[model samples]
Target chain A: MIRDTIRPGTILRVLVLVALIAFLVAPERFAGLLAPLTTNNAPPIYNQGSLVDLTLSHLFTVAISTLAAAVVAVSLAVFVTRPAGREFLALSRAVVNIGQTFPPVAVLALSVPAMGFGEAPTRMALFLYGLLPIFENTLVGLSTLPPAVVEAASAMGMTGRQRLLKVELPLAMPLILEGLRLSAVIGLATATIGSTVAAKGLGEVIIAGLLSNNLAFIVQGGVITGVLAVLISDGFQAVARQAAKKSGTRPQTET
Target chain B: MTMLADAGPDEPAASWRIDRLGVVIALLLVVALALPFATFRATRIASGTGLLLHEALPAPAAAAAAAALVAALAGAVTLRRPALRLAAGVLALVALALGVGAAAAFLTPADNPYARIAPGSGFWVGVFAAAMLVTDAMVRLRLGPAGRLIALAMTAALIAALLASGAWSRLSLLAEYRSRADVFWREANTHVILAAGSLAAAVAVGLPLGILAHRVRRLRDPMINVLNVIQTIPSMALFGILIAPLGWIAANVPGAHALGIRGIGMAPAFLALFLYSLLPMVANTIVGLNGVSRAVVDAARGMGLTGLQRLFQVEMPLALPVILTGIRIVLVQNIGLATVAALIGGGGFGVFLFQGLGQTATDLILLGALPPVALAFAAAVVLDAVIEISGRGKP
Candidate 1:
């Protein structure tokens, strides 16, 4: 199972991590290094707030929305797949399609009128935007179950509920997780837009940079968000592979 | 457990009295009947938003809606025939129109010159319910491609006729559009240009990288991983990231500023969109090429076809449809995403969106938001047609 012991990717990733840590721990040291990118000695650090605060807020917004999206999407998928809820499948599909088609920025704009500003509208927009991927994957996962396995479960006199809970869900968990991973990554990126609506996240740093034409601020925000997204996405892929291994199936490398 | 097994197939029927669809329809009706249809605002963009205003429907509209809702409810409860379902769907659409018309007529009081009205939650619920009904009916009809196309064309024609009749002239969103029609068109053009430019770049870069990744196995994962990482960078952050390096290039390089590759504006916006689009395009190309059946490749080899010949004649033809599908996804995504380019002074309908946000003008925001959604949908449909044609050619 062991592949390359010393991957170029690994080296690049470590270098990035060290650089990021250095940037956060002692940003002033990089001031001289980034001076060329600045306009006539503009401050090299993003002074709006600490990078730590921005990162924490960014992660928090993404986490809340992604978790909410996953729960709702998975539940809706499960509901529609169930025999009693099958009649609503077309309607559910329509709902998700609407959600997917409507851009998140539009959602944010429309929602601001009703929900006001700050975190609430942003959360609502993020939650709606994240629904489609998770719902689609969960539907695929649940529907693609082996008929033989279901029959075998029934042959053991397992209840309908038990078969769904124990067999179908477990088998489908990996795909569902893939959906979650996608939603989270997307949420991670989209959450930055929340700053426009004054929701206080990493986007503030980026926006501030844009307004002031400060390259240092821009890079600082971009690097943090970029690194966080990459790490989270990779982490999710590893977890998905682990789930596939436990499920006793050859991992499908969709990611 | 035995009892559960015995009752499994029967349970669904026993509990199918109304079904989830019926519940949705019922809920929609209940909400429509209870809530306000519109909110009247004193000015275009003010914080002291007034109370939700309920207006009584005209007698004919009220009767029409009641009858339509009744028919829809009856259809939901008892109908199984496709024709009947379609009728119910049409009825729901009528109800929706009547409801909206009633709200539109009452939005600005006859004597009030400075007031604007926005659709309230109940109006949205009714619209969604009608849309769902129509979609469900379409599913029930199981129309072929031609039928669906005709339906779409007919709907478009109807909408065009309505616009021509100036039915929406009084609408706040339309009012907003009318005030700055030239700028609206300009923004729309810019939006299209940005999306198209980025899409072209994405294809140019992605196709080569995808081929290289496919050819060299070791390069596949890391390249794909890098692109995926690029995709996960927020659009704003990605745009921000491009600012510094591009600025440096523009500032330091000779004659680069003249070429317009600056920190802000179209340069950074296009670069960011291109970066975001790479993963889908590249991944699709790889998937398409790899999907070329091994048996067919073997046959090509056995026939003494050269590597390039086999790739062009065998793999390329087979992969074209999937590759196009990838392009469709990327194009649609870019259209939606290009709205953010407005933030960086890249120009687009997002100009209206941000302005609307700043001014607290909902109609102005919608003026920007609606076009990109429409554009994306159009791209999806047209690309789907292309995919269908290519697939048919294969067979």
Candidate 2:
């Protein structure tokens, strides 16, 4: 089993992970590799703060905002789909659809006016911006469940609450996870822009680089962010796939 | 897909029913009435005191505006006809716009260049509620594409008339626009170029690549995966990543500087946007082409049409709607991303946005932010209509 787990894909993933960790811990160690690209005397490694801490802060912001968004969006989706709350469905859909057209950067910039410069506004922007995909997917997931399965739950004398918690939620879990994944990916990207608002994140490194004309810092920030986005997205996809398999549902193909 | 398709069963016309959505709008309007209508600042960037509606407007005008709000709330509950509801909503919107202008004018001390009056949270909430009212009424009316376009035109005309009348002259947003009118237009042009130019380039390259991926079965997944990876990179990071390599090329390669290739500015911004746009463009093309019925292609082939001829004359037409959908996505996405190009001196609306951010000037930020949003929204609507029209003529 151990040997079977040591496939090429796993090896590649492990190597990438190791490289990311090494880069974060001692970016200066790679300064020689990047020296050819830098013309100025400015340090090649971003030294204002540790890249590891910035990465953690970035992940924390994304996680907190995505969690808040998932909670609120899932509840909103649940409410709108319920018979008693169905009257507000159109309004909710309109809000979600229109909200998405506003870019994350624009939203982040706009939030600074109301919330001032800090992680607070950043989190708020991410939460609001992340609401769409998760809400939309949860709506789709819950509504598209096989009617017979719901009927079978009903026929088995399952109460509405029980049916929702036990039957409906389990079946909807994979798509909900997929939605969360998209929201998280978006939040991670947008959080980089939050540094402009004085929020601590990887964006600080990139902005510092941009201001100082330091190519090394820019590359460090950009490459790490890009890698994090891809890895987190892939991680979520893997989890979603697992959920789908366990639920006996076919995994949804990425659009 | 039809989850929100007017699920409520029809009721008798004589019966009274509470519009639940109307209730929400009415609540929002109430909240709007209670909050500050505008802010009065001694200078453009200074913090200001919030002014309530009654304080911001003359007594009679304030009373009239208050009455209109009450009427709108009542109408929301009692109005049964869609036509009447739409008319009421539009009237309320017009009143709200005029009220905002009036508040700005009243609050600003005449002949004082330093005084600035900006619309506050209440004004925004009122606008939101009024917009929702208008949109809900329109959706209920089930207006056709032409009617919707006409509605958009009328709204635009109303705004143009307001601007021409100088009703919003005292507003700080208008002041920001006036001061940098030339720069605003220039940046606006650059923004359009960044978005449209990148999209055009993406289509030029993505289309053929998409067709190639479709034809070459083994290439599809890898091609899509590569593009997806590109898409995964945040716009800021991607822009940063491109700067060094492009800079090196511009420095080492002769004539690259003359060709306008640089590490920063439009070159990298454009390249980044072009790279970002490829996935949607290419993916949509593949999906659209694959969706074309094999039977239809076979029929075209039986008619002695060559492969290229079949692709153009038959498959392309059938696939056009989906391809257009891709274009819509790319256009909207690029419009938003173009604002980020301002970071690297790409010269778009983001210049105003970032400048506003640095200065903490809300009106400047609004000036920068609002146009791109309006553009993206307008593009989505127009493309959606186009897609629908194209699809309508199909089987």
Which candidate ranks first by DockQ, i.e. highest?
Answer: 2
Q: By summed lDDT, which 10 consecutive residues of candidate 2 chain B come out lowest?
A: B1-10
Q: What is the lDDT of residue B76 in candidate 1?
A: 58
Interface RMSD of 1: 8.5
Candidate 2 lDDT, B281-325, residue by residue in tens: 889889999999889999999999999999899988898988998
lDDT tens readout by residue for model 1, B1-395: 00001111122354335455756776786676566655567777754333232353566666666677767867756665556776776677666654555556656678876666666666676666666666666665655445655666776676677567776566667668889999999989999989998899889998888888888999998798778878887788888888877887998899999999898898999989989889988999999889888999999999999999998899878988888888887888888889988988899988998888777787888888888977776666567556766766562
Taken over the whole model, the C-alpha lDDT of each candidate is 0.76, 0.86
Estimate the TM-score for candidate 2: 0.96
lDDT measured at residue A82 in model 1 versus the true structure, 0 to 100? 88
Q: Per-residue lDDT of A1-255 in model 2, one digit per residue for the tens?
A: 223355575577678889999988888899998777666677888889888999999999999999999999999999988876776666677666667778788888888888888899899999999999999899888989999999999999999999999989889989999999889888988899888888899999999989988888888899999999988887888799888988888999665
Query: lDDT of candidate 2?
Result: 0.86
